[model samples]
Target: MENFDAIVIGSGQGGNPLAKKMAEKGWKIALVEQRQPGGTCINDGCTPTKTMIASARIAHLLSRSDTWGIRNQGYTVDLPAIIARKNEVVQQFRNGTVKNLEKAGVTVLMGTAVFSGVKTLTVTMHDGSIRELTATHIFINTGAAPFIPEIPGLRDVPYLTSTSLQEEVKVPPELIILGGGYIALEMGQLYRRLGSTVTIVEKSAQLMSKEDPDVAAVIKKILEAEDIEVYTATTTEKISGTQDHIEVQLQTAGKSHIITGTHLLVATGRNPQTAALQLSKTNVTLDEKGYVQVNDQLETSCPGIYAIGDVKPGPAFTHISYNDHLILYKNLFEEAELSTKTRQLPYCMFTDPQLGRIGLSETSARQAGYPVKVAHLSMDKVARAIETGETAGFMKAVVHEHTGQILGAAVIGTEGGEIMSVLQMAMLGGITATQLRDMIFAHPLYAESLNNLFMTLEK
Candidate 1:
C-alpha cells in the first residue's frame, strides 16, 4: 500500500505538470501512467505530426526550386528515412519526459489504474502485481483516443488511424483519407508531397469546417493546387480491401463514387479516455459525449477531484492542456480563483499556409449583437511577402465597430502561427486597434502585415 497527498492519473501533458507542481509544493505525489511518460502528444500526436510536416515542407520547396532559377533534377522522398527520423524524435522527447518526472521526486507508477473506492485506486502493474494507493486529492488527465467511426465493412478492412499510421516507414502509392480536419489535411499533404496520389473525403461542407468558411476555402485551393483531390460534403459509404489495394465508396452531391488506394487513413476526431477509469465508483459525472463534466474551475462532481485536457470538455490542444495545469495549480496551491472562462485560448492548424484564429469569429461577433467591422489584407500586398516569394494568403481582423476593440483575428499565410500570437496577446490584454496601429513594428517581416490589416479598419 502506498499513500500520497495527490495521485495524478496519466502522465501526459496535464498529469505530468500537475504532479510536478504538487511535488514542488512539498506534497507526496504519485504519477500513474500505463504507457510512455510523455503521452500521445509527445509520442504519436504533435511531435511526430509536426516532424512529418517539416519533411513534407522541405520536399515541397525542393520541387518548387524552378522558381528560384535552380534547375533541380527530379527529387525522391525516402519515406522510410523520414519515418525513422520521426520515431527518433518521439523517442528522444519521451525519454526526456521520463527523466524530468523522476527528477521532480514524483513516484511514477506504470500500470492501469482503476477506481477501487472513493479516493482509492488499485493500480494493476504490468507484471500482474497489484498495489493500492490512497490520496487526499486526485487528478484525472487520461487524455483521449482516436474515434474510429463505423462504416459498413470498415471493421474487416485494414485501415490506419492517426496513431497507427505514424509507424509506417513507407509511403503508399495511393492514399484515401476520411475526415477533413487538420490531421487529414496535414497528412494528406505530406503523403502527396512524397509522391502519393491522395484523396480526401470530408463530411462537412468544406475542409477544416471549424474555421471560417473563407479561410477553409483558401486552404482547399492550396491543397488542390498540390494535386490532392478533395471531396467536400461527402460521406464514406463503405470500405473493402484486398492484399494490394483498398476501395472506398464515397457519396457526394447525392452521387456515389468509388476510389481505390493502396492505403486508407482515418483522421476522425477523438473521444475522452474515460472508459477505463471506472468513474461509476466515484461521484464524477460525464456528459452525453462521454467527457467528464466539470465546473468552470475544472472541478468534477466529486470533491477534491479535478479533470483537464481532452478528458474534460474543451479544446484539445497541447497548449490548452498546459493552460489547464496553470488553472489547476492556482486553484490547488495559490489559493486563487480560477475558471476556464477566464483564459483567452487560441487554436492553430499547421497546413501549407497555416490557419490560426483567436477569440470570436466575425460571424460569432455579429450574432452576439456586436456591430463588427472586418479588415483584411492579402499577403501579396505585404512588402516582406513579396520579397520572400511566398505570398498566397491573407490576414483578417475583426473588431467591434463602437469600441475598436479586437474581437478576433485570423491569419493564413507563411508564419501565420507566429503572427497569430501578437493578435492573441492583443485580444487577451484588451488592446484596442488604435494601440496596434500606433505601435511601431519591425520592417520587412511577415508580421508587418498586421500593421496594414489594422490600418484598413475605419476608426
Candidate 2:
C-alpha cells in the first residue's frame, strides 16, 4: 500500500488545478484519471465544440457572401479537415494540462479508483493491475456523462451524443436531433451549416426552455430562418433504423408523426458519473438525483473528502468548475474565507448569435415577487449590427423598478457574450440602468446600443 498527502480522482477542470496547487505547496499528491487528462472541457465540451462551431460559422457566412457583394461560389465544407483541426486543438490543450500536473510533481495515475475505506482507495490500473493507495484528503471531481433517455428502441439504434458527434468526419445528408437545450442548438446549427438537412425535436414548449418565452421565440425565429425545422412540445416515442438512416416516431400536441433522417443526435441531458466511484463503501452521501452532496464549502459528508463541478448538484459549466477550484484552493490552503454561495451566475450559449445571460431572468424576477421593469431592443436597430449586416436577434434587460438597480440582462445578437459582460460588471459594481444609459460609450459599437435599450425603460 502506498500513501499520499492528497489524492484527486478525475483530472477534470476542478481536480486538475487543485491537484497542481496542492503539489506545488510541497505536499505529495496523486491525480487519477481513467481516460484523458483534460476531462470534458478540453477533450470534448468547450474547446472542441467551439472550435467546430467556428468552422460552421465560416461556412454559414460564406453561403451568404453574395449578400455582401462578394460574388463567391462553389463553397463547401471539408468535414475531415475540420475534424483534424478540432483534434489538433484538443490535443494541444490536453498536453498543456498534463505538463502542468507533471511540473508540480503530481503523481499521475492512469486507472479507475474506488473507495475501499475512509481515506483508502483501490485502483484497477489501465493495464489490468491493482494498486492500493491511501490519502489524508480525497477530492472527487469526476464529471457527468451524457444521459441517454429510456425511450423505446432508442438505444438499439446507433445515435450520437454531444461528445461522439464532435468526432464524426462525415456530414450527414439529413440529421434529426433530440432535445432543445444548448447542446442541441449548437450541434443543430453546426450540422445544418455543414450542408445537412437538420430537424430539432424538443419535448419542451420552446427552445432553451429555461429562458423566457420571448427570448426563446427570438432564437426560434433565427433558426427557422436558416431552414432548420424545429418541433416543440414534442415527445420522442421511439427510434428505429440502421447506422446510415434513422426513423423517429414522436408526438406533439396530441398528434403523432414520424421523422426520418440519415443521422440522429441525442442531447437530452447529463447525469453525475458516480456509479463506479463506489460511494456506498464510504461515508459520502448523495442527493436524490445521485449527485454528491456537498456543503457550501464543497466538502462532502466525509470529513476530508470533497466533491466539485458536475459531480455535485450545481450548474454544469467549465467556468463554474474552474471557480470551484478557486474557491476550494483559497479556503482550504490559503486560509482565506470564501464560499460557493452568493456568487454571480453568468453563462453563454455559443450558437451563431450567442445567448449571453447573467443573474435573474424576467420570469424569475417576477416569480420572486419583485416589481420588474423591462427594456427590449432589436439588433436591426443597433448601428453596428446594421453596418455589419449581422442583425438577427435582440437584447433584453430586467431591472428592479424601485431600487433603480439592474437585476439581470440577456443578449442574443452578434458578440452578445462580450456585450453581456458589460451589464454583468455593472451589476457587480451596483451601477443602475439609469447610470449606464447616461454613461459615454464608444461610438458605433454593439455596446453603444445599450444606451438606446435602457433609454426605452427610462420612462
Candidate 3:
C-alpha cells in the first residue's frame, strides 16, 4: 500500500487545484482520474460548449448583418471547423491544468478509485492493474453527469446528452431538447442560432423553475421570438427513434401529440457522480438524492474526508468549486477559519442574451418572509440596449422593503452577466437601492439604467 498525506478523487475544478496547492506546500498529494485530467468543465461542460456557442453567435450576427446596414451575401457555416476550434480550446485548458499539477509535484494517477476501507482506496488503473492507497485526507470532487430520465425507449434509441452533443461534427437539422432548464435553453439557442429548427420541452410549468415567473416569461419571449418552439407544463409520453429520425410523444392539456427531430438532446438535469465511490465502506454521509452531505466547512461525516463541487448539496458552479479549494486550503494549512455557508452564490445562463443572477429572487424573498420591494425594468428602456437594437429582455431587483437593502438582482440582455456583476458588487458593499438611484453612473450604459430601474421602486 502506498500512503500519502492526501488523496483527491476526480481531478475536477476543486480536486485539481486542491491537490496541486497542497502538494506545493510540501504535503504528499495524489490526484486520481478515470478519464482526462481536467474533469467535466474542461472536457465537456463549459470550455467546449462555450467555444461552440461563440461560433453560433457569430452565425447569428452574420444573419442579421443587414440590420446594421451591411448588405452582404450570407456566409456558410463550416461545422467541422467549429468542432475543431472547440477541441483546440478544450485541449489548451486541459493541458494547462496538467502542467500546473505537474509543476506542483502532484502524483497524477489515471485510475478509477473505490473505497476499500476507512482512509483506504483500491484504484483500478487504466491498464487493469490494481493499486492500494491510503491518505489522511480524501476529497471527492467527481462532479455531476446528465441524468437520463426513464422515458420509454429512451435508452434503446441513441440520443445525445449535453456532453456528447458538443462533439457532433455536423449541426443538427431539427433538434428537440428534453428539459427546459438552463442547459436545454443554452444548447437549444446555440443550435437554433446555428441554423437548426429547435423545440424545447419542459416538465415544469415554466422554464428555469427557480426564477421568478416574470423573469421566465421574458426568457420565453426572447426564445420564441427567435422562432424556437417551447412547450412548458408538458410531459413526455415516449421517446422512440433512430439517429436519423427521432420521435417524442408528448402529453399536454389532456392531449397527446408527437414531434420529430433529427437529433434529440436530453438536458433534464444532473446528478452527483457519487454512486461508484462506495461511500458505504466509509463513514461519509450522502443525502436522500445521493449528494454528499457536508457541514459548513465542507467536511464529510468522516473526519478527514471532504466533498466539494457538484458532489456536495449546494450550488454546482465552477467558481464555487474553486472557492471550495481555497476554503479547505486556508483552514488547513494557513490556520485561517473559513466556511462555505456565508458565501454568495451566483451563476450565468450563456444564452444569446445571457441571464446572470445573484442572491435571492423575488419568490424566494417573499417565501422567506422578507418584506421585499421589487424593482423592475424592461430592456427596451435601457438607452444602450435601444442603441444597439438588441433589447429583448428585462432586469429585476429585489430589495428589503423596510431596510432598503439590495437583496438580489437579475439581468437578462446583452452582457447581462457583466452587468449583474456590477450589481453583485453593490449588494456585497451593502449599497442600497436608494444609493444606487442617486449614485452617479456614466451616461447611457446598461449599468447606468440601474438609476432608472431603482426609481421605479419609489413610483
lDDT of 2 by residue, 17-41 (tens): 9999999999899999999998999
Q: Which 10 successive residues of model 1 have the least lDDT summed?
A: 450-459
lDDT of candidate 3 over 253-339, digit per residue (tens): 989999999999999999999999999999999999899999999899999999989999977788999999999999998878899
Model 2 scores a C-alpha lDDT of: 0.92
Candidate 2: TM-score? Answer: 0.98
lDDT of the candidates, in the order given: 0.88, 0.92, 0.92
Provide the RMSD of all predictions against the true structure, rounded to 1 decimal.
Answer: 1.3, 1.1, 1.1
Candidate 3 structure, TM-score to reference:
0.98
Q: Which residue runs does candidate 2 get wrong by more than 4 Å?
A: none
- The local lDDT score (0 to 100) that residue 357 gets in candidate 3 is 98
Query: For residue 297, what is the lDDT in candidate 1?
Result: 87
Quote each prediction's TM-score.
0.98, 0.98, 0.98
TM-score of 1: 0.98
